[model samples]
Target: MAKPWFRVKRFGYGAGLPCAWQGWVVLAAHLALLIAASALLTGRPLPLSIVVITSTLGVVWIAWKTSDAPWRWRDGGED
Candidate 1:
């Protein structure tokens, strides 16, 4: 078993939202942000958009961390 902090069920909601289902909503939001950012960045050359690159990196990191955490499906969605 993994620590609660390392669990995917614990990844989605925090501070403001506490429900496990909220996590899925948050995850989807992040995915959408990533897609939008990527589309915007594609219009410009890499060298001209450091901000987009940084933002994309941050988004990727969040997405990666969320997915990396073990989703405790056995818990039926609870952490």
Candidate 2:
């Protein structure tokens, strides 16, 4: 199988920072989209909310799919 782009967080219930360039690109693009959406959708609460929520879900889905391990609560113990 291909190497994962993200590593599971040691003390959280989700993926951590990017472990590969591809992951970094994904993160950067997501952030850029959010910023652009906020700037363009200012004063439009409904559209802004929809864009933010959809972008968030898209990022989460990408992270989950590219993570090295399944997400779960962690106490910093060896897995």
Go through the candidates in order and give the C-alpha RMSD of each one to the true structure: 8.8, 0.9
The Cα error of candidate 1 at residue 63, in Å, is 10
The stretch of ten residues in a row with the least summed lDDT in candidate 1 is: 1-10
What are the lDDT scores of the predictions, listed in order?
Answer: 0.47, 0.92
Q: For model 2, how does the per-residue alpha-carbon lDDT over 1-79 read when each residue is reduced to its tens digit?
A: 3989999999979999999999999989989998999999989999999998998898899999999999999999999
Which has the greatest lDDT?
2
Please provide TM-scores, in order, for all candidate models, with all chains considered together: 0.35, 0.93
* lDDT tens readout by residue for model 1, 1-79: 1212123333343222223453455556656865776687676766436655665576445444545343333434544
How much does candidate 1 score in TM-score?
0.35
Error of 2 at 31 (Å): 1.0
